[model samples]
Target chain A: MRFYGYFRSSSAYRCRIAFNLKGLAPEVVTVNLRDKAHRDDAFLAMNPQGLVPVLDTGTARLTQSLAIIEWLDETQAGARLLPDDATARAEVRAFAQIIACEVHPLQNLRVLNYIKAHHGQDQDGAGAWCRHWIAEGLAACEAIAAAQDHRGAFAFGDRPGLADICLVPQMFSADRFGLATDAYPRLRAIRAACEALPAFAEAHPARQPDAQ
Target chain B: MRFYGYFRSSSAYRCRIAFNLKGLAPEVVTVNLRDKAHRDDAFLAMNPQGLVPVLDTGTARLTQSLAIIEWLDETQAGARLLPDDATARAEVRAFAQIIACEVHPLQNLRVLNYIKAHHGQDQDGAGAWCRHWIAEGLAACEAIAAAQDHRGAFAFGDRPGLADICLVPQMFSADRFGLATDAYPRLRAIRAACEALPAFAEAHPARQPDAQ
Candidate 1:
């Protein structure tokens, strides 16, 4: 198996945490997004979306971090990434989607670049954009986490499952944009619990081979 | 079961298709997005994200269309929303996320309103923004679908599944924005195939109780 990703992509970071949790280490290939390697024809051929964290599973290639994580949970032997109960699983996935769909895309590198180019946003403006979406989405996540009937040390249950997998990365991003997460006590606590684990710690952007 | 949604919400439309496919008719509650009904304390208490397509399953209220659809597939008795094979499931999910995560969020009412309020984009500007993202994302979806070795009439297989559930609504959004989808023949074909089915037809925004 081979994993293609950049060091700082939250999407790739997600798959990295999933890999560590599952106790599988695929050979890593760093696609330098800073250099626009992801836009190259070679990378586009591999993934027409020109995105990171493409998992080549020998037999098939997987795109999208959540889908790859779900596939890992289905076929992998180690820790389960999703809960078994249907409703619980839905809760975890919904939490993940709040970050993945609602928050992350609004502040994606491409989106920021587009806004900067066409929407007249400079670096500070883009950062503000990121912070706005991050803060709003995290507030929702905190609310949902606080409302959970059986909240654990993690987002969903006692173990660090899909929700934590998504939360930790978005928290990292929150910090990146200088958005203080202190307002979200539940998310802060969840991030603390997740960061203490080796799986999440090792997958941090600062720990990657391609980190500057 | 109770389903809270807005007629024009693409996310809500995805769940409506899933419900129709699963043959489960949950009680429908239309939250008027134009009137900001989702921001009411009552709705916010149910969904902190203030988004539509919340499914109350008596035991638990589910948010996030993909999560709700997956839950329906896992617990309901009907046509399978996800394929059996893990790799196949990932492909279908990746296709769905291309629309849900990458495309839909950029054109969301909240995001567009944010851009208008802060980014100096007028109505035409927002429409352009939506078209750019919709075209870019549909191009990726088309490329991926065209690359599939076993292309079926739908996005994945012979029967409509998760990918088609997402694609149909996104296609609707594209048309609403006056974006021509002719460039994405694969997606156009998939949309045509999906729209021919009663399951997809019944879920159209025009057919909803509160469409106007």
Candidate 2:
């Protein structure tokens, strides 16, 4: 298997965490987003969306970080990324989706570039745009986390799973934009727990081989 | 089960299609987005994100259309919203995520309102913003559909599943924005096939009871 990713992409960061969690060492290939390598013809042919974090398993080529992570969870027998209970799984998925579908998409590079190019937002303006969505999303995540029955070291229980994989990268993005996360104490504590794990520590954007 | 949704919301449309496919009639509770009902205190308490398509099953209150659909697929046995095979399920999920995580979020009302309120965009400007993202996304979906080894009546195979559920709502949205989708012949054909089904047909935004 080969994994295509950029160092700082939140989506790629997700795949990295999942790979490490599953204890699978697929060959790593970096697609430099900064140099527009992701938009190259070869990359686009592999993924029509021209997005990073395309995992090729020889049998199948997959895109979308969440989809890839779920695929890993299903195919790999070890570590259960999703819980056995149906309702608990829904809670975890909903928590992850809050970050994936709501927050991260709005602050990604393409959207930010669109705002800058068409909406007349400068660098500072784009930062503000990113911070606004991140803050809105994290506050909601905090509320949800606070409401959870089991508030251990991780997002769900004592074990770190899919929600933790998504939350960690999002917090990284939040820190990048200089957003204040003091309000989300539970989320910050979960981030701290996740960061302490070797699986998550190795997957950090700064720890990646292609980090600037 | 009770569903909270707006008729034209793409997220809610996905849930409506899933419910119809599963042959379950959950009582519909309309949260009118046009009137800002989704942002009401009660709705936010139920779903912190303040987004629609929240399904309360008396056991679990699920948010996120994809997560809700997956839960329905898991709990309801008769109809298979996702395939049995792992790789096939990943393919379907990746296809759906292209629209759900990418296209639909960009053109939703809140984002459009943000552009208008902050960027000085009027209706026309917002429409252009919607069209731009829709066109770019659909072109990729068309490429994906065309590249599929088995080009059946739907997005994945002969049966209309998660990807098809996502595609139809997106096509409706594309038409709403006056974007030309002629370039996406494969996607349009799949949309035609999906629209012909009673499940997809009844789930159309115009066909909903809450539709204005």
Winning candidate number (lDDT) = 1
- Candidate 2, residue A209: how far the Cα is off, in Å: 1.2
TM-score of chain A of each: 0.98, 0.98
**Colliding pairs, model 2:** none
Q: What is the TM-score of chain B alone in each candidate?
A: 0.98, 0.98
Query: How far out, in Å, is residue A143 in model 2?
Result: 0.8
- How would you encode candidate 1's per-residue C-alpha lDDT over B1-212 as one tens digit per residue? 99999999999999999999999999999899999999999999999999998999999999999999999999999999999999999999999999999999999999999999999999999999999999999999999888877757988878899999999999999999999988989888889889889999999999998989
Question: What's the true lDDT of residue B29 in model 1?
Answer: 94
Name the candidate that leads on DockQ.
1
The Cα error of candidate 2 at residue B171, in Å, is 0.5
Candidate 1, A1-212: lDDT as tens digits: 99999999999999999999999999999999999999999999999999998999999889999999999999989999998889989999999999999999987899999999999999999999999999999999999888866757998878999999999999999999999988999889989999999999999999998999
Model 2, B107: alpha-carbon shift in Å? Answer: 0.9
* Model 2, span A1-212: residue lDDT tens: 99999999999999999999999988999999989998999999999999988999899899999999999999986688989888889889989988988889999899999989998999998998899889989998999998888758888898999999999999999999999899999999999999999999999998988999
